[model samples]
Target: MTTREEVARKAGVSVAAVSYVLNNKPGVSDATRQKVLEAIRELDYKPSHAARTLKTKKTNQLTVFVNYLGDAFEAGILNHLEMESRMFGYFVNFQTYHPEREEELRHFMAGRIDGVFLLGQSLRPETLETLHKAGIPVISVMKPVEPGPVTAFVDIDWTASLQKTIRHLKSEGHLRIGLMANLSETHAHRTRTLAFRQAMKAEGLPFGETDILSGGGRLEAAKAAMLDYIRIGRLGEHTAFVAASDLMAIGMLTACRESGIAVPDRLAIAGCENVLMTLQTTPTITVLDYPRPEASVAAVRLMVEAIRGEPVASRLFDSRLLVRQSTHMGG
Candidate 1:
């Protein structure tokens, strides 16, 4: 319950100067800012967000709207986003839009946030329109559609990234490859599947229906699909397997191990999102490095630009294939 007034008195500055320093607003010198910060630390002062928002009409908060993924993956990205937002004196709020309720979307749009970042698998056109009309600057982290005037986006070039993976596999003499992906009605899954098919076709590689495995994003779902493929005796026939995410890749790897199949020697595997667990595995999975920190930084920069009424071009980052023991042979 320490107050800003106590800190201002300790620092010998006006309450307004304390406000400017704490809020990181303009019109405060660096030396005065340091004094105010020291006083705040010594006095253990915590500013009231409610009071600050009421007075300035700026919440200094941003929202990230995504589907409900598991805690581990979501926490990794959220931590990076929070760190980047802290540099600009902003806080992040995460909201999961209920799949069946449009009212939830409307409720979240009712003025608790200054800007929004869409991380959902899919965003309806009407919802986008509503957010645009509300003048809330939005930046999409993945699967962004054609944004209107007030919105921007930052994402990986998924098609090219997949193409790079395919080329690496090809160089490793992998002609027959399989793809394991989640079959949820998500824009990202669909787009990446399409990219995989297109890349396979362009390389004149024959990919049959059996080569594509689909399931939910759960480990059990992935294990079930992979085991089903194995029970049908379709596992090691393909030279390589490319999974949509590291989680799925781990499941696929587990399935292969349980089935008494050697990795890389019999079936090479690669995945996206170079998660830490992938590196700690026996074969050390090869994956595409998506640069989550860089993407988060770009998203905030674009959001701040839009907040300041400045123009920003759509931002896209490249994903590089990280080759490791999982895909290496004859070394």
Candidate 2:
């Protein structure tokens, strides 16, 4: 709570002197540094992170911006990223990013973090431009946006993952497949959708407009959407569905339970992201192992190097098909 002004007043020096002492800059003499250090000890003064960032131009602090946190989408990523970043002597923080509040986001990120990570949150072009102008590196985790100069991507290969998922569904006796995904046209969502289409085509399955169900990438929303779909009886000839996210798969399962529909037997369902929740479900859900642990470590290491002025490159991990009770057999 002690400010530089208070430290300066206590040390009988100017605020700039306190700043110089705090930063270990060359301007402060040895005598002044000792005085400031003594005063800081006496007053229990702690230099503000913002002040340190301004003085040194390096905070050793990183932040991950996400649409939501604590849910399944971020739990694995955060755990691994924080652990790996700490091993490199960097601190990690999480911020829930809001797309509509670009100005606030831009202001909050300035001088607060050495690097930024986008955990499946979509940012406008201008926002990324602002971060780039500020010389802050941006890395996308999990679901990635479009490839560009501003944001580097880290995720699994969507095409290969979906192709494997489609093949799994095929072996399970599913022909008419549906894709549960986010309605927003974010590059991450688009990539999954396109991969689904490509995979279905390669597997010789039927994919049409009606086969895609927009879930907005939320559990409750997907549940509501699926409930409506069931009421309308629009699920004609579709024996199975693959969710772009595990959350959506769980949501659809809830809807089926409420509607007295059985899973696997009546409507087989599989999803992506083998989050922990998938195993706990009554009928364990099948999924594509997203390799979050590996992805997180890779993302943080790359981000740390990028923040340290090293050459950085995007990384894509492989996804493994996990078959569970929901899709027949165990994962």
Candidate 3:
């Protein structure tokens, strides 16, 4: 079958431009539209389904562009986003945002997808321009160092949250603390890392060379890294550890268990998510309850407002700390 890619090649324009012409969406000039139509005629190209959405009206469709859905935290956010989107008469879908394939984004369901929620992505300036020309608004769930064309950001106050966590750890007598975080250096994780540093600074604690560790954000890699640290006796450097996610905290617990290290006695650990597993573990994890649902609602609302051409501002929600056995001071 003749494909859209073939048609775009024949038209000598971007695949996204072809999509605009096919759906009668604005942003493609008459000259370019004519070329796309001519290419379709020559190639006998047919879209899988004719889009019923009109460019002028709300399609009630939104998509979330994310780095990965594999992480429990991200997956949980997607679940809440879908539920919350329904409350506003919108349907939601998610995609693994591949910044490497820049054109694929604008070329995807162009007419039907109204806006995008960036879970953790940095859309390059050119890619941002393409989305802008295509009339799609992009909103980040985390603040950017420089928001190129992003409509708004809906996120947590990472600095404040981390500082608060630090205070709680300090109260528990964990002055010399270390951080465990994801291996990927996305903007959100980077923000968290910076916040951790600022939090340590505010507490007058020194974060030296061995103070931070990065592994996979999920369970297995975290356990592996912890095991390596234990074997090398680096785990003794800090009385307590602050994990960026609950999964990492659990992995640390698992490592401690395997290595015959007692929790709270040998070390204390605090995590960032208050998910169920945090409680179900043998030693309940101390955590900062991530406001996933609230953030989802805020992100959806901002996208809806932006879709209507309404003025939108960035929103911030706070995470509450929940103390558990994992970070209790040993008697």
Q: Tell me how far the alpha carbon of residue 251 in candidate 3 is from the true structure, in angstroms, after superposition.
A: 1.5
User: Which candidate number would show the highest lDDT if scored against the true structure?
Assistant: 2
Runs in model 3 deviating more than 4 A are: 1-51, 54-58, 144-146
User: What order do you get sorting by lDDT, best first?
Assistant: 2, 3, 1
lDDT of candidate model 1 versus the reference? 0.78
Candidate 2 per-residue C-alpha lDDT over 1-331 given as tens digits, one digit per residue, 9 for 90 to 100: 8888999999999999987777545678889999999999999988777657776786778888766674686778888889998997778888777667779878877777778887765677787788888778888885555565645678888888899988877887788889888867663666788888888888887899888888988889889989999999876568888888888899999999999888888888998889999999979998999998899988887887777678888888998998898988443
> Residues 137-203, candidate 3, lDDT per residue (tens digit)?
8887766646656888877887788888888888887888998877465446766777888889888
* TM-score for candidate 2, residues paired by index: 0.84
Once superposed on the true structure, which residue ranges of model 2 sit more than 4 Å away at CA? 1-50, 329-331
lDDT of 1 by residue, 1-331 (tens): 8887888899999999998887668899888899999999998887777787677657788888765557345556777788888898888988775657756776666566778887634566677667667667778776643344437777788878988888899999999999897666654556567778888888888887778898565566777888898899876679899987788888888888898877888889898888888888888999999888888888888888887778877777898999987788852
**Candidate 2 Cα lDDT to native:** 0.82
